[model samples]
Target: MTDALNAPGGLSRRRLLTAAGALGAVGLAAALSGCAADDPLAQQARAGDNKNYVAGDGSVTEYAKDTRKPPVDFTGVLYDGTKLGSKDLVGHVTVLNFWFAACAPCRVEAPELEALHTEFKPQGIVFYGVNLRDEQGTAEAFEQSFKLTYPSFNDKDGQVLLAMSGMVPPGAVPTTLVLDKQGRVASRVLGQLERGTLKTLITSAAAE
Candidate 1:
């Protein structure tokens, strides 16, 4: 999980292919296309055999169905001290990711969360970060350091965590909740997401 995805001057797949095509001229234009067509989450799936994300006592579980709906109104405060409420994200699929900067698994899954944010933003998907047990500076810096575009709500008092304890464990960090347009919990990935699973779940939830 410690690959240098932030490599200096490291060519993104697109950039590398673009440079290749520029040198190749028109001979391989179509060949260079569809580079990211395959699932980006493929790597995580391959690394699945590396770790067991199962929780003790089977307390954490994934939501296997899409029938659950969110409340009509919800509200919270973001890390930047901005107010965010349910009405702001109404009629869109919203993903709430709960994490802390100190958690190693949370760091491992951060990139995938950013990727999902970029991939599904234009598709009517909304992402909200819930920084649990985190300081305002650390949470803000984490978002900035990762280039994460989604706004995060600080759970310094764990108010949101207490509210969601019935559906999610209060001890669970890096928990992801998928909510339908109406603000209902559609699906939840209790632990780290296997790369593309987050994006896929968001897309499916949006379509639902």
Candidate 2:
């Protein structure tokens, strides 16, 4: 396991195992106490409606430079078969969006994400989609339909997701994370991204 998986205050193996088990009222209350009442993950778990995805409230969190955790560590192959790792993201501002083709919020924000990619790529900012579920053909079709220029990772087996489990909620589709030049998470957006908000976040990360 990488540091990202074992970072302080992050999800631990025991917690994950507990989360994977049945959540009765007492268990649900315990989980909710660990996070904010409105936290999408906890809220979704409480709903018990089998929605299969958490619809965040578009919350944005920016970590101060000093408060940021250690640089993230993980590795995965891109949809195009290019291997990438956290080390590769060092010295550049990077954005990672978690999504799947079936996610309605993901579809809604695709153009905005692509637009941001176009605007910032010239400035050396990077963007990648951490696709949670979808076969190659389905993912490819979604990309083609959106005319997305960036490549997504085929994370169906969830290596990328597992590595990022500390930072990202397990089933929060359409979450976006911005990493600073040092590969530490700088900012995060949970839910459908707002173009201006994300643009500002990218700009700030790039400036740092």
Candidate 3:
């Protein structure tokens, strides 16, 4: 989980290969576990596992069907100081990315994330970032530098993180999650995103 994903040169060939392998591993595990949406909320049985993410390994995990957890509820102050809560996203497939101004991988994926925000905007796929560090000006500067339009919450005190409680705790600096229409945790990418995989994940969630 601690592997460096996007370096100064951007996603390396090794990272690409690792992502492919990770996807394969996730698929295999899902298949073996018969994990589907029939009772997605069954995740309650795995509460012990939700303690924290182990590390960043560029892996993607999708909890579709019976394996998806219930919609998470939270409220926080956005970077622009707007009041935001999970209820507002009930009907849409939303993307939540955890990041900060100083993370190299965060900067590397900013443009790509903005692209996803734009591409999915019309489809009702909203993207929001959760700043794990940095104050307003610092986070805003990063957003401006990347020309990102979506609003990010400045969770400097980690209140937003605490709100997550036992479910899908963002364990790494650049974790990305796709919340389904019901606001449930649908899928998560544990490191710097692969645009195609994320797009596919979000698209699938939107369609569902």
Pick the TM-score winner.
2
Please report how far candidate 2 places residue 34 from its true position, in Å: 43
lDDT by residue for model 2 (1-208), tens = 2232244654653254233323322333442332235445334433443265678766666676788889988898898999999899899999999998767667656766787789899999999999988999999988987778998999988988897776888888879999999999888888766676677678767887
TM-score of each: 0.67, 0.75, 0.72
Which candidate wins on lDDT?
2
Q: 1-208 in candidate 3: lDDT tens per residue? A: 1212432433553465466556644543342232222222223212223222333666676664566666788898997779999999899999999887666556556666776788889987899999987888988877776678999998878877776665445557678888898888877787666666687678768887
Answer with 1 or 2, whichever has the higher TM-score.
2
Off by over 4 Å in 3: 1-55, 165-171
Worst 10 residues of 3 by lDDT: 36-45
Ranking by TM-score: 2, 3, 1
- Candidate 3 matches the true fold with a TM-score of 0.72
Comparing candidate 1 with candidate 2, which one achieves the higher lDDT?
2
In candidate 2, residue 124 scores what lDDT?
94
Task: Score candidate 1 by lDDT.
Answer: 0.60
The segments of candidate 1 whose C-alpha lies over 4 angstroms from its true place after superposition are 1-73
Segments in model 2 whose C-alpha atoms lie over 4 Å from true places: 1-52
